[model samples]
Target chain A: MGAMDNTPIGGDTRVAALWDGLSRVMDPELDESIVDLGFVTDVSLDAAGRVDVGFRLPTYWCSPNFAFLMVDDIARELARLPFVREVHPKLHDHMASDEVNRGAHLGLSFAETFSAFEVSGTLEDLRETFHRKAFQRRQEAVILGLRRAGWSNAAIVSADLATLDRVVLEDEEAARQKPRYRELLLARALASTPSDRAFVTLEGAPLTEVTLPAHMRALRAVRINMEANGALCRGLLDARYGEAPAPEVPAHEPDHAAHACGGGGKACCGGCARQVSAFQPTAAPDL
Target chain B: MYTTPDGEEVFIIDGHTHFWDGSPENQKNIHGKQFIDCFYGYHSSLSPKDKLWTREQFAKYSADKMYHDLFVDGPDDMAIVQSTYLKDFYKNGFNTIERNHEMAQGQPGRFIVNGAYDPRDGEEALEYIHFLKETYDVKGVKLYTAEWKGESRGWKLTDPNSYRCLELCQKLGITNVHIHKGPTIIPLDKDAFDVHDVDHVATDFQGLNFIIEHCGLPRLDDFCWIAVQETNVYGGLAVALPFIHSRPRYFAEVISELLFWVGEDKLLFGSDYAIWTPRWLVEKFWNFEIPEDIKQEHGVDLTKEAKRKILGLNAARLYNIDVEAQKVRLKNSPLAVAAE
Candidate 1:
């Protein structure tokens, strides 16, 4: 769905673009794309360029702040498409769905929607917190990948962006996160230019040989927490919607496995790619 | 009791459980239904296929079923049934102390029912704590800080009113505070599941034990940091234990960190009944081992002794249960004999 098509305004192509746009919006807490998490159930478009996106969380009691942030990001991301006129993101079956949808429609912020309770800080604060966590989680994956690929601590600590880009990571998890890590690294301005150190603390401090172990320890915690939460969310979402992935088939029966779900290429988790196949939403009709 | 492959008996105290009426007839609003649905999601998602329950059975089960799930068919020596009075969501409240105490009355010495009170209720909260102590004689209270009350969505352990309630609890000899610091949830903007409040309250209420359920997951790092410094802080494995079945690798990673930081003596096992049964969770956890890589990385081991401690000894310590004597008592209990 993400592959760019040359056919402008074609019904199928536009709907694909709509999904691609939604794919870029992440669940801030889990730091995974909403589309991949199966939180996004449907996306429909009309001839007038108005887009309606429907999404649901693993539970009715998912954090309203996160629900709001995702809904807001959906509106913002979909509106970026040149063909899109208005974006209406609907959060279904949540405790604060009405407030979130109404707030999104009126262009209100999270604080505006639920102002009764005290807000610890701006939504930006929450975003920044998750951003730092995402950066750390991605960084940990890349570093662990490098170590597994036979890189020494000294070499890893001193490695620069150019060196990182040139090196090959054999580990699947690391390889997948390499681009994501680099993107955040560049986007957050943590590192820039070819010579910039590939690894740096959230505050821009470069890791030294003596400090790498402690840094890795901190990153490991962050990674573990995020991964655990991600698994829980996926499980709950499956249970709520009765959308559990197909039962595990014998590894020898590759043909049957592929046919049961779909081609194995779409799975985010390596080897068990079919595990996430049920989560992938089919294309919606463009009316 | 879980008898090991070598014939060693391992006592298990399910540190967290719930006996509630989440049935359609009990649901006061959509929140009640959704709350139970969310629990069902957790159940179906993580439980072994054989352990899964139908939605109707999960919504409300017979007391005999809970007893069978925790003891007769399960390995738990004693279960701590926690009360969560979601009065706003349910018609008669989710699981009040009255209901739990009543449930425990039928099976003596097999249940340690915990009471709950809202600190946001101010003076009434203190009064309720006293009432809980006198009426129920509760040695522990499960704090659902995210519970909704009228206009307010949630409260914190460090709130001024909460301090007053804790002071009352401490004075009344309620030594255990099982705070629900699991996944992050509602009350927009503020982190309803934040564990930082545990830091402050744990420090102040030194006499009380703060057992953060789900090991403050999704915030394990923060919880670990706080737990490492505070001797009184603990991590309950209710929500985390089910991971042993579905995501063993992830569970190993989390347990490795907890063993390293929180230590084996401070970690407790809980099945979070109705959501997931104890039988499968206990069996899987008993046989589970942290991978060599995770063990070495954390410089820790999930040895036989550690398993024994986490499963029962740790919680037994918190509740002041004389393990040897309790074991003897349970050995002679009517239910134990009946099961045999």
Candidate 2:
């Protein structure tokens, strides 16, 4: 798939020239040459040098802001050449979309088809995340109103996405309008899981440091909490090691709090200090 | 009704996470334990980005969503972080020390760093260990047995080189030393490794607050037996915990067994965050839908206090962090803005 055939465009210099022309018209968003990035799909050139070039949008339905920018770059570049007559953008799949492609293509050009206030999907993802964070943070309406009031980038990501479960937990009542909402609710439910073996017995001497001050680290919290709770069958081991001196290992930085998931390669804590291979299953869990 | 010193919540301590750049050229052989590829359920290639997830990315993604809500700066949060790459060490020095020391540093009882040491470097590794403590104020030290004189990429925490580093961690006050354990005799000898191989060495280094990296295959009870039997030894279920088909009760068995063996305090909190935990939780919701009550049975509290230790505190004390001052600073510390 990598090696490309440098087959010439044959006799028509315009066809070869059109191909050469679009390469320089690169996809601005990707920041790479368009031809090499496989964005330029097809190009047609007539004897009059009328060029019709087609391109696949970076996304299935990418906003055509960059597409039209390249369209103009093509027109200007081709118009500058001695032979070209007309230049038109030929979008194959994206332009035929239900909301965006068909709605605007009638009176508007591809570039003009976009809405200035169109909602960002990533922002929407962040919005949903903020809701979950608000609940986790107990912030409730704190930041939602901030975003609603048009604030800039600001958020509190607790726990690792690795430890978080991205489930749609919204019930039918709340999710009747938006089905995807259910998935979001379920995502954090997993977090409530005990992180270590949740020690219920309270056997150890009243904890050495009963209350922790506020200024702790902020690594994956929810997941670690869930993992810590889940990993525990009893409340806690005795703080006093009968024979063993305390490791006396000083504290480093706190990892993000509230995340329930772990990642690979970039795994934090060398795979969170415990990695059990699935291939070698142990005593079947009771859960 | 709900009141403990930490209050309602468990002392949440994360006890695990690594900070490192994917790039190899940070001038650190910390361990050629190159985190190359990971295979999870045969669908490893499903991810859009091929890069392995790191604590930084984990933090970047999870920061605002969870951290701000869960932690209050002081003992409210605790994390024991380790660095695989020497260049990737945490910049914060000992609690209230230089914020940019760039090595393993335990903050005002907040985030704590455990610097990685490669035994293959021999004396040089030992020297760096000293420098990390003396110069950077690194709190804890980390070593990997499988990483030393690595066999076909790796072997058990029981490996000889790992024992040497473990020797150092015990000698030093680096109690939070983490050891990695791969699958037992990975059918193809090429990938064969056993965490138990170093069991005897760990026994010899008794009293060092040692954590066996991966509980070495959750469902398997062999290592659990060792953790139960060993006096100074403790284990963490950082990865490969099956949460999907298993309900919260299903996990109780291993949790119960781990508690029965190592006792609860010895079992540190581990999410194996970037790699396994998130998906397991997702799959748990997808398949089992375990109830929250089931977790409470194990003494797991969803409230804020318990959240502190599991988040990082258990490791903090186990790591022997100064809990006394960490509490005072939380109220006055500027790093924390709001805490619920």
lDDT of 2 by residue, B1-340 (tens): 1123333433445555543333333223322112221112111211212323443343223333223322432223445556554222212211122322232232344566667676666688778777777765665665544332322223345546656766776676666567665321121111222345546866787757567765654223445656766766666656434322222333433444444445655666654433433233222322332234334433342333323333445676676656655556554654533233
lDDT by residue (A145-180, candidate 2, tens digit) is 223345332221222222222323222211221222
Clashing residue pairs, candidate 1? none
Q: Which run of 10 residues does model 1 chain B get worst, by summed lDDT?
A: B331-340
How well is each residue in B1-340 modelled by candidate 1, as lDDT tens digits? 9988789999999999999999999999888888888888888877777777888999998788888888888898999999998999999998999998888887899999998998888898888898899898999999888878887778888889999999988999999999998763455567755689899999998899999999889799989999999999999998888877666666777899999889999999998997888888877888887766567779999999999999999999999999999999987886833332
Q: After superposition, how far is residue A280 of candidate 1 from its true place, in Å?
A: 4.4
* Docking quality band of candidate 2, CAPRI definitions: incorrect
Q: Give RMSD (Å) of candidate 1 vs. truth.
A: 4.6
Interface root mean square deviation of every model, in Å? Answer: 5.6, 20.4
Write candidate 1's Cα lDDT for A1-287 as tens digits: 23433223466788899989998899998778899887787887766677888888888889888888899999999999998888899888888889999999999877777776665666787788889988998898899889989999999999999999999998766887899999999999989899999999999999999999999998888877887787788778767776644243222223433321112444222222123333456753221
